[model samples]
Target: MNYEDLFIQYQNLEKSLKDKTKLLAKLEKAISKEMEGGDISRCITDTAVMKSVSAEVTSLLQEIESLVSSFDGKEYIESGDFVSQMLEQCAENGVDVTGSSPNFEMFPNKVRIDVENQDIYLDRKKVACLRPVVLVQAIKKGQEKLLKASFNANKFASELIVAYDLALADLGKNPGTDLYLQKLYNYMVPMSRFRKDYDLQSYAFDLARLYAVGSSVEIKDGRKIQWGTSRDGKKGIRILDGNGREEFLATIRLF
Candidate 1:
């Protein structure tokens, strides 16, 4: 089946499962009531109905799983035309996107879509479905429901300074030592607690914002961390945003 047909089938199967589940719930209550009222035949009938409906639900779930798992990479993930079509569909739906290959971000919410992995990340957590409309829905939900709270530069800088210091101390490195960008993310973002959801992707956005829009804190006498780019074929942290020219950040100098 084509992607559209597959998506529709998944939705229909889910609806059927939900209906069957509701019938099973009613049957459970009926069976209990009939048994308590000493209606043996009625209880037996309801129990049988419940068992049959439950079996149907199980079968539907297995079918759904099979349908989702059966798609080959050539049909979607590895197909050049499929990727293009997916992005085109999003643009037609009025979802502006950036970076046409390997990854794409649905703007103005920065919802990252990794086509290679077939994963959609909203805020730092993964969204569950491979549904094609997810690209549009992600932007809509970000605009309507998951609106972000204001980013606090002072709060983040304060926490980040501590994290940087702790990272240095833990590594047995001296003050003002250059730290790896990945090291900071692995060390700091996970160690500190924040009022809002601040995962690694959150770290990416926060750091990008700080670098692009200037932070409120000066770590030591106006000294702060500086990001360095890899020049000798070393891998760097890829910033997955569509708006900017800077793609990878490799090193950081902490003050």
Candidate 2:
């Protein structure tokens, strides 16, 4: 009915949208795990269900995006504007507006504008009072977390190659060298923990191939290459170029 009522309604809708988004994301992840069964008929049925859930999630996301866009034209008045409006209204009604009145109180310093809700309120009140800059920073931080959670090395394989090339060039040693490989493993361990199917030896060999010296090696057909050795005297495969020249491959340390 009024600006205050509309602002409250908008705030409630925003909160509801965020809650629904999180729930839907969890549901999608659960359904995806369930879809990995080996039964063909059941897999087909799961695919259809997944499609329905995905469509619903997409529609909700579009609605939320549209709602956020609509807020651009809405007026966001600061404390000064609020005070000026109150003074003008008081002057029109022949009431004194210079001094603090019994009915009206203002906390100029404590007042903050909530950009999302398009409302102003005192900081002392137990209510959401996020500034626009703070809200943007919060959103960016959440997005960064989401990005990290969904990280996949295959998605940034080129970037990894470039990083290895730079590191090798700067250090004047092959990335497959024992010292650099250990350093790389230490750096990657924390990030690799987030991966569901992470294998340290497999990743180490993959990294070995990216090294300038190891890039010339070719894998033998029907032969599984070992990346690390055991204390029982079992040795790992030696890399060889097309010209039959031996190349160095990193011997991973299990510890």
Count clashing pairs, candidate 2. Answer: 0
Model 2 residue 207 distance off true place after TM-score fit, in angstroms: 65
Every candidate's lDDT = 0.66, 0.42
Index of the highest-lDDT prediction: 1
lDDT of 1 at 86: 62
Error of 1 at 171 (Å): 2.3
**Candidate 2: pairs in clash:** none
| Local accuracy of candidate 1 as per-residue lDDT tens digits, 1-255 | 257777788899999999999898899888888988999998888888888888999999999999878865445755664566667677677665666555565533455556657675665457755555665666656644422557666667767778778898888989888777777776664645652456655566666655554545555456676677664324565553335554556777765
List the pairs of residues colliding in candidate 1: none
Q: Work out the TM-score per prediction.
A: 0.50, 0.27
Model 2 lDDT per residue over 1-255, tens place: 123444665677667667656766765666566666545665566566667756765776676576556543224343334344444544454332223321232211123444445554432333342233333333345434533454333433444434444555666865454333444443444465654344443343344343323323333222222344323312332332234334444453111
* Candidate 2 ranges with C-alpha deviation above 4 Å: 1-36, 72-74, 78-255
Error of 1 at 35 (Å): 35
| Candidate 1 global TM-score | 0.50
Tell how far residue 248 is off in model 1, in angstroms: 1.8
